[model samples]
Target: MLLVSLILLGAIGTRLAVLQLWQGHIYRDKAENNRIRIVPKPPVRGNIFDRKGRVLASTRLTHAAYLWPIVVKQPDWPKNLKYLSQLLSIPEESIQSRIEQAGYNSPTLIRIARSLNPAQITALEEFKTELNGLEVDIETVRDYPNKAMGAHVLGYTGELNAEELKKRQAEGYRLGDIVGKMGVEKAYEQQLRGEWGGIQLEVDGAGKVMKVLGQKVGQPGKDVTLTLDLDAQRAAEAALGDRKGAIVAINPQTGGVLAMVSNPSFDPNVFSSQITPKIWKQVQSKGNPFVNRALRGFPPASTFKLVTATAGMESGKYPPNTILNTFAYLNVGGTAFGEWNRAGFGPMGYVRALAWSSNTFHGQIGRGVGGPTLIKWARLYGFGKATGIELDEEAPGLIADDAWKRKNYNWEWTDGDTVNMSIGQGFTQASPLQVAVMFAVPANGGYRVKPHFFDNNQDTNKWRTSLHLKPTTIKTLREGLRAVVAEGTGKALNVPNLPPVGGKSGTAEAPPGESHTWFGGFAPFDNPTIVVVAFGEHTGGGGGSTAGPMVKQVMEAYFKNNKR
Candidate 1:
């Protein structure tokens, strides 16, 4: 019995020796490696609001399934991933593929799925022992309450690419960080990016949090208020349904952009998710749906006659009463430029030329003012420059001169080009926004206002630049534009019970024998509040027939709602 007891004692001693001497250091090191880890917290982005405090873009709290890259490199990664896949009901291969695409050794957390169900979150927490390093994190994602509404203006956010990461690493941007890709979101990124916060957590060997060490409060981004009218924006978007076109409505007094829409816009929410290749291809396949067509330049057509008229009247070359015989066509440098009407109006004065949209009279007036004078006036009217709006991707419309023609096309500036310029054709280009501003000159009593999208305290005089029009010339021009809606091609816009609106109609021949229709005008004629410019691509009709009604509809809605 004594010998039996001795044998049991030795067995116990041998087990103790193996543990204390051999495996002791390994166990000690493992315990030491289980450290208080500093986990990065993402900042909440700011909300975006329209002029009336309607939320256009906001953020929502959501749960995202993530795979930590450092933990993903463990030897038992396959087993761990399999357990995670089962717990979350996600494919194991897909999780691995996501990790690989996100950089297998990257320090950043890879998002596997977004907006997890409550049950999925519970399973993740309950199965924490089996799913090592797989975390369900709380995150703030962009939410557009109105879906695709104002998408072009509000823009979208997405994960930063390698190039963007490299460029923005110094700005505290990391991999998997979402940044604005276009539109106002891109333009106001600095304002919208908030300060990130983090927490130090005491974790176990399996990466389970045992205690919260400390945390730093993160700051949310600043709210951005835009000069957009939601109701008017809805009206404009509804008017452009399914057609590839754009409409820009602005307050002529403040130059605030009321509504700017490019049809075929995508929902910004789709970009906030894990965008698949299929969805990306769909977004790209539809007419470059990302581009803001309102800010892009297109031919102005007969609407450009206003610029020629301005140059003619301003240069003292063609007065209001100056008569030009309108034959069927005007021959300049062997180019027969025909009037829009096959049967000529016979004789047209300057005002009647604009009222009837007589291409022949304007073509002669364009020549009388010459190419240089016309180009100078066009630039003076804010063409060939950005409209100074607080938005990205704004294009400076082109106004060609002798040097410009020689530099770009190696062609000389000719009388034919002048004639085309007079009729709002040829090499001259302007955006719908620019067109709205151009007409705002006569509408707002010849005062050139700087267009903007943000409200601030600045003197109105500081923002206002004078167009230097003689009061008499301004009066005559205003009278002629009013005549357009009363008795001319713009008669399509005349409403029965509403105040009279005055504007011009334009139709420019585009590629493949199609026409781009345009209408630029102001409401009420006397006390104009808004100037709307509508452009329709390949509409196969004149502006009076195509875009005039749209402008009329938008104006009617505005007046009906505002009642001022």
Candidate 2:
């Protein structure tokens, strides 16, 4: 009997030793995890300023209510959600949607409500004991002071998506972090996002804080100053009105973007807060309110004539005084190319032809220089490539060559295509930003200035290329452009009150009843400072009637405020 009792006692001792010595750490770690919580403190995002020190974007501190899913059971969610819905004055379905969007079933804390008013906050605090696993968290909300005024340029921030988080996790971005989704905000995200810090807290089994263990404050992001003129931006947007169009203004002296406007702008503030599915669909529709039209491609219309004129003169096919016979229509192959005015400008020199914007005259020039020469001149003037602007949304406009045509369309280039391109009506396309650069080249000493938004001590003089263009040719083009505003298609823009402005007008055919209008030029013809380009989509009217006055209004306001 004594031997049997000793055997049972030894067996019991062995079992206790196995659990205490071998598996002790595993259980201890589980208990520690239950009692300790690491709460992350999101750092404040940086502020954005315009060149004149106007605040464009900044951060505002606000309170948000979060739910600890581990502490709140699945069965109790309905009751808890109902209580939260009443306290926050939000629908219970909305709270559930928020929880689902946040993946509340996962280990991560879910933010169920944000932007709490004082009344909501007081109620949440007073009813804290009644709410299960509910905690208030301080959140940094992105704020755009000017609202939708510069939405494209300022951009907006939103919570990171799964794809973004996967890509940025190595860069220290958390799942719930708000990130720049577009515009300068996205481009300078690294500079604008702050480092996240955290605090270790001792918590009870119910997830209530018992003691503070340790904490580290987060670092704020650095500020970014842009070379945008607020007043000029407002003026440009006002001139554009509610039409589907864009306006780009550049400092002729430095290629610095003064003002850029894309109409039908959505409020960045809408993106800063939680975006509703309906609002998201509305902004992401065919209208594409998020796209920066200044950097988007469009049929350039007659503005591309500037490229044709440059090519013609440089190829030695058409001199400054070279006279070309122009009629109502010119037949090339099976296609009949016609001028805007059926009566035509008759036979005229290059200067007069440019002023009249005679399609027959440019078609003849296109035939003389052919497609190759036009493409070369177009590249020289910064086409078929991004202008190397600070923004990433810029489109490298199509300047299709023979090789490109064969590869993309499986067709060879033809004289008909050349003629149509010369008039800026065929496959040729460009952005308003490119148009501004094309005209600014002549306005600013015939050099291609790299368009920029930030202040760089870049030697613009060194970046200037004559594009193998002769001084005489530039002078002729400049004089002809002046004549355009004085007596030709752009004559409607000859405002008596404002200083003399020289520009080229263009009307490119769109669909059956639509035309894209374009006007590009510099002001005060004698001493130009600002280069402006205005483009209207499906305007029906030509450049002189549609985009011309918009440019005039912007230029007039700029000159009035600047006063060189």
Candidate 3:
């Protein structure tokens, strides 16, 4: 029994010695790993520049204050909250609420204050030693030098909150990051957001960063240059002059968007970094500054007459010289449709009626062209389809047809519908961008060019297409459009010493006693350089009085500046 006891005692001693001496380092390393450490790194957002290399959107370093919840140890929570609130210039209740929400056990960093100025930084520094949980770090925030000018196009960013973080995690985004919320920023987010960089640091038991172990430097995102002319954009905005409307201008030859203006724009800087709930609520409640009206759909008004003319000409239903008698009013299905002026060209040809914008003439042509032909020509002109521009939330303008009417309204086609469609009214709707494309088609000699804002290093030649039209048809339409500007209703927009210009005007009635006025035209009629479309909401009268003058001024500025 003594020998067996001795052998067991020796084995137990050997096992204890092995555990203490041989595996001590391994267990110590495991214990150290259990104290979790996470270092968040942010990716550099892309830069936005104009076609001439002017900076439109960028990022700058700013100071952000954070609180480490686990390190905070206070006997009186209220006292600690008061101290933080006074230092951060935040409400005491808000500070206390955030602390309670962060919980006590976790070591996650919660943002208490952000974008601190120099004086605020000094104030925060004074409390560093006394505030156990407080931490100040440097981070980059979006900066727009030209405030509120291109708000609808450039968009803005905001810090990721808890719900946003969950979405980011699912989409492979790291925590505590800013993302594009609208405009080009949101549409090309993947290309604009580069890879993130990370750093490893050794921390002491006190939770202080003791030493930097390793780091991978972040790469700056690619610079994107847009086709927008800042000066022209500003001019367009100025011309809008306190009206609710939108304008889209494009280079007819290349399909490059020159200027896009939507009035009542909000400053993008408001959304950069962290947008407080109060500010966000205010923005949402007041007049919808977030809406991009250029992409929003509206009745094309008389501007749609261009499409009717194209359809009629293309379908062999009517020539430019085809004659129709225009009475002051015409009756279709007991509904009297009349001209805006309440006077008609007693007996006129197609060209004369188009230049005069005779409602009765086009209405008669629409009947001759029929519904299918109208829809075909409208689709061919790029209506009823998204322009495929690199912007968020584009609306495809509606083009009602027999099938569409049957499916949506559960009704058959009527002569009244055809007449209304011919006049660019009824259920047909389009965006300013779509109208710009339609104007560009005739200006470019019948080519259907896809509108684009970014070049992105692609060869310009690759994006060009030629839409062949009969030379006779092109000539007839060109003369008719010029006559409209020369001696007809569009005479108000005629400018002296500039190249010959051609255009069409339209007035579309909105619901509940509102009106949408529109004008679409191209400049230097011989070799068109630019195509412009302008619209004004609730503006009384035709496009000539409301939208034409605006288009004229913009064209004048563009021609004088470009001087080609």
lDDT of 1 by residue, 1-564 (tens): 999999999999988888888898966654444455556677888888988889999999889877667554467778877877776666788777767666655534567777677888888777656655567788999999988888988888877776888899999887567788887788888888788787878777677679998899888888899988888888888887887889999888778888888976888898776566677888877877878889889889998888888899889988776888997899899999997777789887867787899999889988988988999889998998998887768999899888989999898899999999889898888999999988889998998777777756467676678898988778878887888888998987787855878799999989886799999889878899899888998887889889988888788788877787
Off by over 4 Å in 2: 1-20, 73-113, 117-132, 204-208, 281-286, 461-466
Highest TM-score: give the candidate number. Answer: 2
User: What are the TM-scores, per candidate, against the unseen true structure?
Assistant: 0.88, 0.90, 0.88
Better structure of 1 and 3 per lDDT? 1
Clashes in predicted model 2: 0
**Ten-residue stretch with the least lDDT total in model 1:** 29-38
lDDT winner between candidates 2 and 3: 2
In model 1, which residue pairs have backbone atoms overlapping below 3 Å?
Answer: none
Ten contiguous residues minimizing lDDT sum, candidate 3: 30-39
* Residues 488-528, model 3: lDDT tens digits: 87887787856788998888889786688988889899899
Candidate 2 TM-score over all chains jointly: 0.90
Report the number of backbone clashes for model 3. 0
Among residues 3 or more apart in sequence or in different chains, the pairs in candidate 2 whose N, CA or C atoms overlap within 3 Å are none
List candidate 1 stretches off by more than 4 Å: 1-33, 78-113, 117-129
Q: Over the full model, what C-alpha lDDT does candidate 2 score relative to the true structure? A: 0.83
lDDT (C-alpha, whole model) for all candidates: 0.83, 0.83, 0.79
Clashes of each: 0, 0, 0
